[model samples]
Target: MAAPGPVHEALAALPLVDHHCHGAVTADLSAAQFASLLTEGAAWPGVSPFDSPAGVAVRRHCAPLLDLPRHAPPADYVARRAELGWQEVNRRFLTASGAGVFCVDTGYAPYPLTSPAELAAAAGATACEVVRLERIAESVAAGGVTAGGYATAFEAAAEAAVRRPGVVAVKSVAAYRTGFALDPERPAAPEVARAAGRWLARGGRLDDPVLLRHVLWTAVGLGLPLQLHTGFGDADLRLDHADPALLTDWLRRTAGTVPVLLLHCWPYHRQAAYLAAVFEQVYLDVGLALHHTGPARCRAVLEEALEITPFRKLLYSSDAYGVAEFHHLGALCFRQGLAGLLQDRVDADELSLGDALRIADWTGRDNARRLYGPPVSEPARDSGGPPTRKV
Candidate 1:
C-alpha cells in the first residue's frame, strides 16, 4: 500500500461510530497487570508481552499518542504512561480515536473500567450499551431459580435487561461457553428447566447448552441486534468450534427477525465474509484483531473479510477493553488498512475515487449509524454543533 495520500488523509479526517467495544480501565495498572491486558494469554514466567505484534503495535502507534517517540522502549512507554496517569492517558487515546459514538458491550469487564457514560464523557461522544446474554442468565440463576420457573425466569431476565435504557443490542459469548455447534431450534421448556436445575445445583458457571440456546432466542425475541463472539478470543474459547460457519443453522432460524453481528472473525474471516454474503442478518468486524495484526499487516485481514462480504454487512469496532490505547490503535489500523486497500483499487483504476471514498465512509461511519440508529450529536469535526439524538 502507498504511503499517506489523499485517501488516507480523507479517512483520517472522517469521524467514526464504533459499533462494538468494551470500556476502558479507570485506574493505573501495574506492569504485570498491564502486560496481562496486552495479550489474551496468561502471563508467562520470563517472557515480555512487548515481544509480540500487538505489543510492538502499541509501542509504535500508541507511544506517540502519549507524546513518546515511535518505537519507544517498553520501559520508557510504561513509565511515561504511569507518569501521565489513567485519566490523561484515556483522554488522549479516546479523543484521538475520532469516534463520535461508542457502542459498548458492558460485559467481560475484569478491571475497574470506565462506564459507557464515563467513556462518552472521556471521548466527548455519545455512548450506548450492548447487554451480554450470558451475564443476564448468570444473574437470574444466582437469584434462586426453581426448576419449574427456570424458563420463565430466564426469559423475563433477558427481556428486562434488553429493555433497560441505553441498551441498543444483545451479545453472547457462546463461543466461549457451549460453542455454536448446538441445535439452532429453541430448546424445549423441559430441557431448559432440567439444564437450569443442574446448573443452579452446581452453583457454578453457566455452560449449559440448553440455557445458552434459551438466552440467544430470548434476545432474538426482544427484537434487538445480536452480537456473537465468533472467533479469536482468550484461551478459554475452543477456536475450532468458534467458527461463524458453525452457526449457519442458527442464522437460518434467526434470519429476518434480528441482526446477527459476528465479532472478531480472524482465521475464519473468509467464512464470516461468506455468511455475510449469504445471510442478510449476518455482519462482521475483526475488532482488536485488526490493530493486533499491526497497521502494516492488517490490510490482508480486511481484504479477506471484504472479499465477499457486502459493504453494508461490515462494521467498525475496537473490542477494546481494560485499556484505552486499543481504542486509538484499532481506529488507526482500520483507517490505515481500509484506506490502503481502497486507495489501491482506485490507483489500479478498478474503482473510481468517488466510489472508494463513499465505501470508506460506509465502512467507517455511515453503516454503523444506519445499524445502531442516529448518534446524539456532539461537537464533532464536521458537525455544526452537538449532534442531536434521534428520538
Candidate 2:
C-alpha cells in the first residue's frame, strides 16, 4: 500500500486542531489494562476486579510478557511523561503536528483534568483556545442535562490555559454512561438484559423517556457541541443499544438546539454524515484515538462527515486515552485525507487549495474556537503532572 502515502509525513505538515479528548487518560498501558478488563474479544464480561485473563489478556495485563516490536521509547518519554505529562503531550502535539489549537477536558473529574494554570503558562502568547468545564457531571446528577446547567465553574481556567496562545474549545462527553453490566449469575449475555450499552444497561425500558428528555434538552441548551459515544460503548454492551439510528428522536427534537459531536461515528459513519447535513447544530468528529477503531475507518468517517456538513462545521478529535500517538495519528489522518480527497475529485477546481485549507483550519480549530472560546495561550503543564483518569 506504499504505506498509505505516509500519513505522518502529511500530518507533520498540516495546521489542524483536536476538538475533543479527555485530558487525563492518554497513556497506553494504564488505559489498555483498564480496557482489557472491560471488553474481552468474543464476549465482553466487564471488569469485576477478579476475572483472570487468558493468553493475550495475560500478556497485556503483564506488560513484561508483552512481545512488542521494539522502538526506543520517545527520547524523553519517561522524563517528559513525569515532567509535563499530558500537558507536555499537548505542548508537543502543537509542536509536532503544527496544530493551530486544541481543547482539553474537565468534567466529573475530582481534580482538574486539564491544568488550566499550566496550560495558560505554556501558551505564552499564542493565538490558541482553551476551555474547561465549570460543571458538567454535577448537572447530570442534579436531574438535568443542558451544557449551561452542566455548571460553568472557572472560565478563568480556560482563560489561563490559552494565555500561551492556542485556540481552545470547551470539551464535554455525552450524557450516556460508559460502564456496562453483566450477569455473572446468568452467564455472559443475559437474555433479559437490555444492555443500553453504557448508560442504563439492556434493562432500560420506554419509561426511560424522562431521562432521555433531560439529556436531550440539557445537551441542546448547552449548545457547545457535545461529543457522544454513539456506537460500541462498553465491551459487554448490547451492540443494538449503541446503534446511532436509535438516537433519532434525540436528533429530531434537538434539531435547532445543541450541536451533537458524534464521537466514534465509524460504526455508523454514513449515518453520522447524513445527520451532519440534516442538523446544522450536529457535527462529527471521526476518531479511534481511544483504541476502538483503526486508521482506515477514521479516515473514512471524517471524509464522509465532511462530504455532508460544511467542512467548517466538522471538528477534529482523537478520543485519545493513553498513548500520545492518538494525537499524532489523528492529525496525520486529516492532512493526508484532505490532500488525497481533493486530488481525486478532478472537478471542483473552484474548491481552491485555499478553500480546502480554510475548511481544514475551520474543521481543525477556528470554528471550534469561535463557538467555544479563543485559542488558549497556555496549557496547564506546570500546575500538575498527569491528571488521574480513575473516575
Per-residue lDDT of 225-298 in model 1, one digit per residue for the tens? 78999889889999999999999998898877777889989989999999999998788998979878988789
- TM-score per prediction, in order, is 0.94, 0.57
C-alpha positional error of residue 279 in candidate 1 after TM-score superposition, expressed in Å: 0.7
Q: Model 2, poorest ten-residue lDDT window?
A: 179-188
TM-score of 2: 0.57
Model 2 C-alpha lDDT per residue in residues 1-391, reported as the tens digit of each score = 4343332344346555566554433332333343342232433455332132222222222222122222223222333334555555545543444555445554433323444334324433123222333243233334423333222222323234323433233333232432112111221222212221223333332123223333334344433445565654445445555556566655665665445666666666567777777776666766552233333444555556566666655667655433343444456555656555654442357566556555655566555554444232222321212211111
Residue pairs with clashing backbones, model 1: 377-386, 377-387, 377-388, 378-387
Off by over 4 Å in 1: 1-3, 374-391
Candidate 2: where is the Cα deviation over 4 Å? 1-14, 24-94, 108-175, 178-209, 289-297, 346-351, 375-391
